[model samples]
Target chain A: MDAAVTAAFDLRSWSAAHLDRVESALSRWVVAEAPAGLGDAMRYAVLDGGKRLRPLLVLAGAEAVGGNVQAALRAACAVELIHAYSLVHDDMPCMDNDVLRRGKPTVHVQFGQARALLAGDALQALAFELLAPDDEGIPAGVQARLVRLLARAAGHEGMAGGQAIDLASVGLALTEDQLRHMHRLKTGALLQGSVLMGAACGSADAQAQDALRRYGAAVGLAFQVVDDILDVIADSATLGKTAGKDAQQDKPTYVSLLGLDRSRAYAGELLAQALDALAASGLRDTRALDALARMVVDRDN
Target chain B: MDAAVTAAFDLRSWSAAHLDRVESALSRWVVAEAPAGLGDAMRYAVLDGGKRLRPLLVLAGAEAVGGNVQAALRAACAVELIHAYSLVHDDMPCMDNDVLRRGKPTVHVQFGQARALLAGDALQALAFELLAPDDEGIPAGVQARLVRLLARAAGHEGMAGGQAIDLASVGLALTEDQLRHMHRLKTGALLQGSVLMGAACGSADAQAQDALRRYGAAVGLAFQVVDDILDVIADSATLGKTAGKDAQQDKPTYVSLLGLDRSRAYAGELLAQALDALAASGLRDTRALDALARMVVDRDN
Candidate 1:
């Protein structure tokens, strides 16, 4: 295999181990020994398969700054939980009303809307709980920073704001700037958090954190652009979920606005920008960062 | 007016002033000079009329312990923002589907579901942001504690968990214990946070915090039970929003499970328990706590 593919597979293995650790910690903190049903929905929401890209960025960011991945793992899980909660709630009847997620019935479809909503709310709370553990090894200030960042990213100016823009632009064809603004808040912000959180892991210098943030923004938008491209080319079997749903929903996408060819070009440009940011940070280990940039567009999923 | 009534009204006014200050600060922090429209939806969500009861409790809890109310104000406003967010999301089409709230169309009704959802999410983030202001004088550990407490109350075992139970038991007949569990999770959790936060406001002893927590828990349930009763007895005009909708939906309620008279008695019992907890704390200036406990069931909204 080429170095790129080898790195992708290697990073996949590396990120999976960290993710498993995160998932285990989450299960311990959230699930009680009894009342299995209440926790069942939580598990269902968390365990649903995804790329684990955000968590990987967090670990990578931390590792780049000589911090242990283990220290940052809880935050990794917390961000994922926030992301999962968003999806569950977003699929509700009043929202996107999606039935299939990851090729399975959505949480609301299986657990009912009320439970789904509650599950989402609970998950959001769990994110914070995970960040502010009873053990105070992490500095209180850092924990507080984590709380503030995650909350803002998950809330208005970031993900929620993006979703608001998306919702408002449903029928209308939004301008390129408008679409970018929406995507930046919705997807870019969380991805940025993943990186910023990693920088936060072991007192990484502020300059490094700032550089990684730029990298995160570039990668996040590139990830979305690739997604829009894949929706047209990839089949549901390879994608492991519904494909072309964006087009069907008439949701404005990079491909719809910029066309597929230009969108792919944009992804490449963003990947370069991300790498440039990492280089600017004066980081020596580019292995994980390099792998992530390649994986953003190259993966079938 | 009775002394209790007079005190409650005075508190209502005083709390409003504090809330206005907090709201103004929040607007300054979150909104920008440009993008007036983007910030407008969020500003509306925060500025909309509601009794700032949660913030009042935080201030009350602080004053009860002889702490500076100004020091506790940020945390108070943060909790209230979270509460407001929950209300916005809860009234969306996927959840309660209510059109009116606080005598106005619900966020979703006014801004559409997507914006409403986003607004709710944003507000949640803003609450956390408010908790950890950079130049603020509160200790970092205390702020971290506040964030953790609020997170737990809002998350799985508190408000969200309560919401899950409520969603699960919509048509089913729940036992009295199950009903209490729901209310405790949903409403009791935040209420408990209010008291704990208040106790944390100054340098109250742990014992005092614990006593106030018990007081909070008791009063939380009392408050919800009163809400259940009011829904049964009060008209929409009096309540300022939809009334009798809970029963119409056939959702489980305290009154439904225990009957109206029994529910009222239970509320009284809870109020007494709250008072006992407050008294056990040995607070000298029990005026705020006393007024708050009385106000739990006395007011219309």
Candidate 2:
């Protein structure tokens, strides 16, 4: 579609409708009455939190592939759960030691460290459980596919693997290639996996799937690149998290390696790459994915 | 199905063969080359540790139900991964503050708290990944079923939920019913889940499934009762963990509530109940499950 058509697509309205579905589904699905108030902590970590970017990607990707509605919704919620759980654990004193997240006290700060630990663990399990449902509303093949995609994204070879590199790389200077590798595993895998999962909900042929993969990769890396830029430029108030903390922690980043100007330029390049991939996808509609790509690169947060 | 026939079934030989399969599958499947040494910590936590009782239970349960071989093996490892991950997290300073486990330093003590946390998180994801493989060796329906079963066992409603209660109930004088509820969630869910998951790998009739469920419940509870008894009576060296830990932490247990003689008798009763359930299952062969139940109640450590 042309820029005029894309601009007229009303991304906000689309997001609003989808986010409503996602929020309601999450509220219903996440356990709130678990034994010993564990559910309370789980609900606290997940509900009313973050920007829901992952869910948007899932929904958008599913839309691109004409994916199954039920599967898409579950995939959306499951990806978000994984994201939320990572934040909970990362904020622990043992990990990032951060006190604040999304403008609220971190889970460990609010509900003691032990409950926070279990809450994160439970959330991770819930992600997989949600992906692989008992009923046939989502096909068995689709269910297993979603589960594999999600687990690979969230598991050791993906997000956790990246986080390990992050933890071990403190005070070390990493080359651009090394930084990209880490970011690709850490943040990029889940973002790409979200799209793949959404596509898995439906049937996307090889060509279309490959194009979406490219789109997802470009968009995912752009997110981290933009994040690095924002850390340098945005304040904690605007970011809804502690900004410039990467520098404080001596962690390597795109901005640190390439300078602010180069990092900004790199994010722009990635956005263009994402848009090109979406154009080449051969799908009739990719407005949501297009808008999300722009939003990732342009958002103040 | 007579006791004489059961006695002649050779549980040790059966377990030895299955345990070998489980070990090899685990070694090959659990990520050993994850970025930044994360894999090292994960392997350490999972390998050369514990009795692998959960895997044994899963294999036995599957055998009893004539489960699909591939799915059964995956379920066995998946349940054990959940068990191992739980142990890793539970041993952290914020939770049990355990220094040693499986006769060695805990994950946190050996790998540091941060890597321990990530390793546990990754392992949980891997469990679901293993359950929901991409190929068709295990049917998609079975994959989805196993994921649901394992997640419910490991998530907020099961192990994590039980742990939350345990954390809250520390130093409190819990009644027998209250203790049972806590232990059921903490340990029983996964144990029962292993059986249920094993059953899920095959086409067990509803009647047979119900019988297996009963057997699982009885055996699961008996395992914990025996654990409590061992905590009081067995030495740390014998138990491969710190004996008397529950008492030292002021955590309530069967020994603390019902005392030794009563706990022993209760365990015996549960074992009988388990045996009865196996007979009621009407499966052609339940010798493996029968032997496992006996092992759970009769083992010293």
Candidate 3:
């Protein structure tokens, strides 16, 4: 194929194939075995879910570094579990209080509040458990690295910290920088951690690691920017979550601060930066990473 | 001193000294560095008070095996963090809904519900982060093993699952076997995991490991049996929590299943089994373990 033709390579087939693997891995790992209702709630939160963007990022990063597929698969599923648990907790009455998510009732809405709380807690533990399985296929060093990255990304300094900021910032005007910082920790940390974890699966030289980190940062910010835009532009049916939630909650967002037009332009700039980092990565096969960046910027939801 | 005099060594000084170390490690590790309210909430949930039995068990287990003190300290604090987070979440309005814990307002009662929820979530993540720090003082293999042990003990098949069963069986009558199974997973698993995690910090032969596991299981269940007895007999002020909560919530307990006398006897039996296993381990310096096992059964609160 010509260069232009290859540049326009179809991501649909790639996503479909990888999504199948991600779903199967998630299903096998997230079992409804014990604790009866709690396991069911965990499975409900994680399985048959929203877009598997974090897992895709992980797999794509692994491919870029020629990493181990088994480790990448585990990393991918682990990140998704963290994401799913966050969503479950965030939608509780004490938090965002949303009734709908991914076109279905939230875990709390479906399972009641206490069960939802336990389910989220269990899911978080399961993520770490999956990362550090007793199996010999994944090296102890890799397991340790993955746990370190994921734990930091999910902990007080990362996603949970961001959520706290978001909670405290409700009805308060935030500067563009403050908003960016909040999103960077809340959503950006885990997204970046996913890329690093994927890279950790095998080996990446310093240059490649640095480039991947840059790509991850750009893509992570772009994701939140686009999400803010989608909350404004898309309907709840299309978004698979309550639309315009930020505005309704009086929470500051990208569109709220930068305006819709500027937010769109900012996402475009981030997409370009992400692609630039990929180009500098000195890796031959980062097509998927490039494609995922575009998808993040262009997706309606 | 005579052997009898040495055997009757005071546990207070020993516990006091080790508790000082555990507190310092926790204070150093669980910082209020960023995200504003989150650090405060996490600190509030973890610091100040609790029996710190899990951390003591970890230290004692490590000492018995001639394990690394640094690794054991980290594991000790990590288990305590998990225990603290679980209590924070369990005390929320949606769960047990108690307002008092450790002689003060619960996390949700002091911090708002949302912040309390986030704090608990962040604390759980922090537990894993402590287990897998970037420092090289703890080996990668040990880190992986610790993460695996903690995760399983805390996840659905263990602590969370036990909570689920407890929630579901609130009004239902449970058989002695069923109740034993529930307590084994809920409280017993993490206590057992603490001993195992401490042992993982150093070398333990198969025979020693098996004996420690048995000892851990016995002490873990005995702790709960004694807890149930205390709930019936102790006052809230003495317990530092709302006493008789299990009965108030109409939850089943050992005292309810077997009469108070039989329940007390069962606790004694379990304590005896724990000491027997420790003796079989062929480890000379298990003075702390022996003392801790006795403390679990004899403590008033």
Candidate 4:
């Protein structure tokens, strides 16, 4: 096969292969220290569902930087665990009060609300546990960096902070900038963090790191824009959860602020920005990232 | 002063001084990243209240181990954050449904269930964030170990695991062993983790670490036993919250299972065990740890 032919990335196969690794690791690690039936709740929340996008972003970032494979794997799972926990808590009666997620009952619905809350809390701790592996597969420096990156993204300044803003923003008119800021913290930080954690797993030049940051930012925003679009146009079945939840809840979103067509167009623009930043990275290969970026924009759900 | 005379450690002075340091650090770090009023809820939950036992345990353990001061400070704050978050969640309507904590309205009562949930989640992340400081005040190895100890103690098979069992055993008649197991995970794990994290901050040989572990376990279980005893004998004013609430809920407790006198004796016995472990550690100075163990057994609240 020609170099150009080999260079062409097939995201389906890539995703399939990586998802298997993530699924297996999640299964093994999620139960490593769970007591009694709590492991069952955690496994239910983590395994056999979701797109596993964050883990893929982590792996792709690691590949771009030729990062440590063990650290990359752990970071990948850690991010997904964070994402899963957020979703679990968000679906609780006290939060979003949702019943469906990833075409199944939300954690709170499957397990009781209290169990769900405990599961979410345990999952958050389990994430850092994964990063700080006892066997020392990765260096301690990388472990600290991974924990720092993850904690920042998941904590008050990042996802939780964004959710706070979002929760308070309900029924209120939020400007494009404000909405962007909210999403930047809520979703963007972790997405960017996944990339940075991957980079931290190994060596990445300052310039390359900057490029990856921009790529992650663009891809992250593109994801939200696409999500907003899907919430408006895609059916509940296709979206895997109730469609139009934001509109139903009167939450401000890209579609709510910019209309569906503009949101779709904006997602494309962001996708272009992501690819441009990836190109600036000057890595040996970033086709996986590019394909992911495009997929984020073009996916119907 | 003679060495023997100085060896008579005063816990009151030690706690007062360390509490000032812990409180100030917590105030600075808790708000460092909070968005909107989420920080307000977090600060409210963390500051100006509670016994601050966990932080004291960490500091004392560090002092005994001659550990890195900076890392010890961070670990102290991190473990407390986990403890605070757990309380916030535990007091929510979906869990224990308590309306009071430390004589104030529960977090969910004051901030609403949704914000309370987010605040607790943020605090947990903040715990990890504190451990993984960007300035590198602590070595990466120490940081990893600190995170591992805290995460293991806070996650399943630890605090959350114990809570799950406690939640499930609401009306059940649990044996003494079963009740001990529950409290060990629910409350003992983080308490024990405080000591281990402190030890991890610098240097402790296997023998010393083992001794510290034993001391932590004894103090941890002693704390719960004292708590149960207090719930039976102390008033809401003295206990800083409702008393006799355990019997009200019919949940298994040391007092409920073992009777008040035996439970009190058990706490005293555990305190003795903790002191014995310190003696076995063979460290030059373990007076602070000794003081803390005594405090855990004897504190009115």
Clashes found in each candidate (C-alpha, N, C closer than 3 A): 2, 0, 0, 0
State the DockQ of every prediction: 0.49, 0.90, 0.87, 0.84
**lDDT of residue A160 for candidate 1:** 75
Candidate 3, CAPRI quality class derived from DockQ: high
Task: Assess the local accuracy of residue B205 in candidate 2 as a C-alpha lDDT between 0 and 100.
Answer: 95
All candidates in order of lDDT, best leading: 3, 2, 4, 1
Task: Sort the predicted structures by DockQ, highest score first.
Answer: 2, 3, 4, 1
lDDT of 1 by residue, A171-279 (tens): 7898988888888888899988888887777666666777788898999898889988999999987776678888888899999999988998999999999988887
- Residue ranges of candidate 4 with Cα displaced over 4 Å: A1-6, B1-6
Q: What DockQ does candidate 2 have relative to the true complex?
A: 0.90
Q: Alpha carbon lDDT of residue B259, candidate 4? A: 86
Off by over 4 Å in 3: A1-8, B1-8
* Runs in model 1 lying further than 4 Å from the true structure: A1-9, A30-38, A68-71, A284-286, B1-13, B22-41, B66-71
What TM-score number comes out for model 3?
0.97
Worst-scoring 10-residue span by lDDT in model 2 chain B: B1-10
| lDDT per residue (tens digit) for residues B1-301 in model 2 | 5555455788888888998999999999876888788998999999987788899888888877778999999999999999999999999999999998989999999989999999999999999999887775788989989998998899888999999999999999999999999988999999999999988878899899999999999999999999999999899999999998998999999998999999999999999999999889988778888889999999999
TM-score of each: 0.91, 0.98, 0.97, 0.98
Candidate 2 vs candidate 4, lDDT winner: 2
> For residues B167-225, what per-residue lDDT tens digits would candidate 3 score against the true structure?
99998899999999999989999999999998999989998899999999999999999
